[model samples]
Target chain A: MTRIAEKFVEEFYNSFTSEVLTAADPAEVVDRYYAAEAVQIADGIEIDRDKLIAHLRPVRKNLVSWRYEVHEAVREQEQLAARFTIHAQLRKGRMLSTEVHLFAEFAPDGRLRRATQLTRDVTPQTPQDVTPQTTEAAPQ
Target chain B: MTSRELRVLGMTCAHCVNFVTEELEHLPGATAVTVDLPTGTVTITSDQDLGLPQLQAAIEEAGYDLAD
Candidate 1:
């Protein structure tokens, strides 16, 4: 259970990052990982599938590159929990880094049924060496 | 009954509150569980004072960390 959950967390972010940044149809990418009825609340705001798709459009357009560093992941039955950091590089040399704590419930088919996340910006030590941040707008 | 309050990490939603409440309620002597989601504070009422290990175990079983 532990290993499976950890691997799932890693793969989910890796796939989402790669596909959303490069795929011509990013909505299809969202569909592959999240259920049609999936709801995500980040920092108390809620977004359903259509809103998520709308959110991904600008991300796909502006994101240059991104990566995840998963610190921990665990699962009990269908409940999954993870703590990770996202480093994103955007257009025009802007960067942002954020640490995230996420909890999610998965459907029987392994797609996300619902998720809630809390994120905090990771301040870079110096202005000239700023790190990347997640492009997901909900955390801002 | 005695009441204990503690902070838990990685709890970001109502579902997390449910999971923690359910697990803590299973502990021996526990009577009630209340969670403050925004602050990640959980208050548990029980017949006797709960030990740190016992509380830690329940929180961990719910897939969260008991804040130090």
Candidate 2:
């Protein structure tokens, strides 16, 4: 990967936690990464700048501790795909964790024009996950 | 009214699970969401009436498909 691309990835991880997720005013962070007409899609919904702030507002308030780790990244032409994991320690001992894949399309000036984010929870299972055996078969 | 089992499509990873879980939580009175990755199924427990159309819309917003 080019140095610029690697730098972008490094900045992305920091800016997310520092500027986007933690800031009281997210508009500043938004401006740094997204273009004037940029759109962020989560799931399939289009979340414009203002809406993005709204969506994350609750999370910011409720989050106690969180960690973001980049698993992989690929840069192809003007598009960059970043795969990462987010672990959130929520209130009341509830933990929310997910793997995220983000695809961003950048303008010639290196400003993000559009981005799509996908996420899923992390769940590991063991033998306990299997259904318990019954002592007797069901009566026909 | 108590629980719902949704067969969702395009859920390949844990991110898919998170997106589906978020959709379920948007529903009124949703208490919990259980995502079985191996089966691509989501089980939602709620006290409010969970509508199919609403579930479809939520999933779609997150770029997913709910099997009708």
Candidate 2 displacement at residue A137 in angstroms: 64
Hey, what RMSD does candidate 1 come out at?
15.9
- Misplaced by over 4 Å in model 2 are A2-7, A124-140, B1-68
**After TM-score superposition, what is the CA distance of residue A23 in candidate 2 from its true location, in Å?**
3.1
Clashing pairs in 1: A96-A132, A96-A133, A97-A132, A97-A133
Q: After superposition, how far is residue A97 of candidate 1 from its true place, in Å?
A: 0.9
lDDT by residue for model 1 over A22-98, one digit each (tens)? 66887887887889999999879677988777666545544566667788899897898999877666543455667
Off by over 4 Å in 1: A1-4, A126-140, B1-68
Model 1: per-residue Cα lDDT over B1-68, one tens digit each: 89999998766434355557767887899999999878889999999889989999988766578888
Instruction: List, residue by residue over A31-130, the lDDT tens digit for candidate 2.
Output: 6666778887765656676765554544444445555556778889789888866665543334565677899888776667898987665633321121
lDDT of 2: 0.64
Task: Please give the lDDT score at residue B57 for candidate 1.
Answer: 91
